[model samples]
Target: MNSLSAANTHFTFDLFQQFKTSKKDDNIFCSPLSISSALAMTYLGAKENTAFEMEMVGALHFNEVTENTEGRTTRDHVEKLGNVHHQFQKLLTELKKPTDANELNIANKLYGEKNYQFLQTSFLYYVESVDFKNAPEESRKKINSWVESQTHEKIKDLLPKNSLEFTTVLVLVNAIYFKGQWDNKFDKRNTVEKEFWLNKDTSKPVQMMKQVNVFKFTSLEDIKAKILEIPYKGKDLSMVLLLPDDVDGLQKLEDQLTAEKLREWTSSQNMHDNYVDLYLPRFKVEETYDLKDTLRALGMVDVFNPQRANLSGMTGTKDLLVSKVIHKSFVEVTEEGTEAASSTAVVVNVGSPPTHPFHCDHPFLFFIRHNKTNSILFLGRVSSP
Candidate 1:
């Protein structure tokens, strides 16, 4: 579990770096857990070097369960790989466990051409397959409907029109929906329009929700930042906010940010109970991304290239490769609580802080995490209201 958390931290920073570069000066949001889970299912069909590459890029940590018999080293490696997938399955199952107070759903599905020779027995555990050949548009709509249902209609049209062609062989998808009321709810009457600094020279009016309470908080002098953790009703999940001291200090903080650094900043020892006059903006963010180029940039190239790809594990042949990876996410934060949903589709053809007056009057980074597993469910930068 510790290793898995570490891997998630690393992957989160890696994806954040990419997003920072691509969407400069704009707000960004994503579900690293959703993407990783969906790709874990896709990874089931990867073999040899392809498998190794995917494992490394995905940052999936699997404990090695080795048999000591002679010539069993190779067998052990194979077993370890299988164990990795099993762990993902276990984690996904755990995440989907029912919680009445909080509505959380994580689901996976594989849409394939009707005649595609998919290994139903081996792959069934990871993803449920649906035929996409007979009616491509209908199949597309069906997948979208499933995403909608899974996300409580918070996410729609996940796979945009004309994005899926008739030639698509496989499409792997993972959708996650989360809605939790704050352990200490804020009064709606306290929300008021306030100035949100976009930068030194720009500002905008935002509906700022205010509350005064004792929260887990910390201030890092070295980083010029403050950290705060607000628990949701279940206590198993929380939002950790990181805010820079200076309104223009976000870029500097970003320059020094790392998975290890984040771990240290959010460490239990660093957080102490403190009275905080919290002011957060009421905002909604809906983001979509085409990750082919980004994944390739991260050295996940073979999976997207038909000529060099190796996915024989799925169909016992190299006839398929990922054509695109589409991801869509929605988030709304208000006085009551937070509601967020994200969907990641692997198209086949192929493929802070707080506190201390923790007034978030400027851009900042935040994460919705599952406390038990230490898995980051959603990550975003609120550059604007």
Candidate 2:
């Protein structure tokens, strides 16, 4: 779980950098967990170089203890990879365990061409085989339906029209839905329109929710930032908010950000209970991304290239390669709490807080994480609202 959390932090930052380059002025939101889970399923079918590339870029840690074999055999490596998937399965099970305090769901599925040769024995624990040959559109609808169901209908049309074709071989997907009420709920009656500083001169009106409460908070004088943890109802999950002292200091914070830095900032020792006067805006963010280029930038090249790709673990032949990776995420933060959903499809076509006067009146970075596992469920930057 530590390694998985670290991997998620690393991937979140990497993906943020990619998105920042293009949509610098827009709010950024994503589910690194969803993306990693979907890819981990795909990684099960990767072999040799393909496997290595994914393990490196995806931050999947594997412990290889070979007793007597010369180095490691293909069978041995595959078995080790299976162990990793099993761990992920366990983690997912824990995440989805029934809880009345919070409504959370995480699901994964796989769709393959009916005629395609897929190894039933090698399939990951969460994969569900679906036929995509006779009617590609119908298969698309079915996959989208599953995503919609998993996300409680917050996510729809995950695989857009004409996205799936007859030539498509495999598709892997992950969907996550979370609805958690704040331990210290803000009063809707107290919410009012307030100024949100986008920059030094630019500002916009936002529906700011006000609250005064004791929360886990910290001040990072070194980075000129303040951090706060807003726990959900179950206390097993939290939204950690990082706000810079200066209105336009987000870029500086980003410049100094890293997985270790995040871990250090979010460490329990650095946080303590403090009374806070919080002003957070009610906002919603919906984002979609095509991650082929981003994955390539992160050195996951072979999986997207048919010529050099090696996903023989799935078909026992080198005829399968990922066609595209599409991700869609939605989040709604209000006075009561938060409702967020996200879906990630590896279309292998083949292939908050804080008060402390911790008023988040300006742009800030935030992450939703499971407290026990430290696994990041979602990450985003609230630049506008």
For residues 1-385, write the lDDT of model 1, one tens digit per residue. 4454566567778888889988877899999878766776677788766776676555333222232223243245566566656666666777777775577788777777768667755675554445555566777888899889988899999998777777777777767777877877777777899999999999999999888778899999998999899998778889999999999998888889987888888888898898788889998998888877877777677887778788888888987787667778888887768752322221112112333689999999999988888888899999987
Model 2, stretches more than 4 Å misplaced? 57-76, 122-134, 340-355
lDDT of each residue in 300-360, candidate 2, tens digit only? 8898888988989888999888876777888899766875232222111110343357989
| Alpha carbon deviation, residue 94, candidate 1 (Å) | 2.6
With candidate 1 superimposed using the best TM-score fit, by how many Å does residue 283's alpha carbon deviate from the native? 1.1
Best by TM-score: 1
TM-score of candidate 1 relative to the true fold: 0.89
Once fitted onto the true fold, the runs of candidate 1 whose alpha carbons sit more than 4 angstroms away are 57-75, 125-134, 339-355
Q: List the residue pairs that clash in candidate 2.
A: 169-350, 239-352, 276-356, 321-351, 322-351, 348-351, 355-358
User: Model 2 clash tally?
Assistant: 7
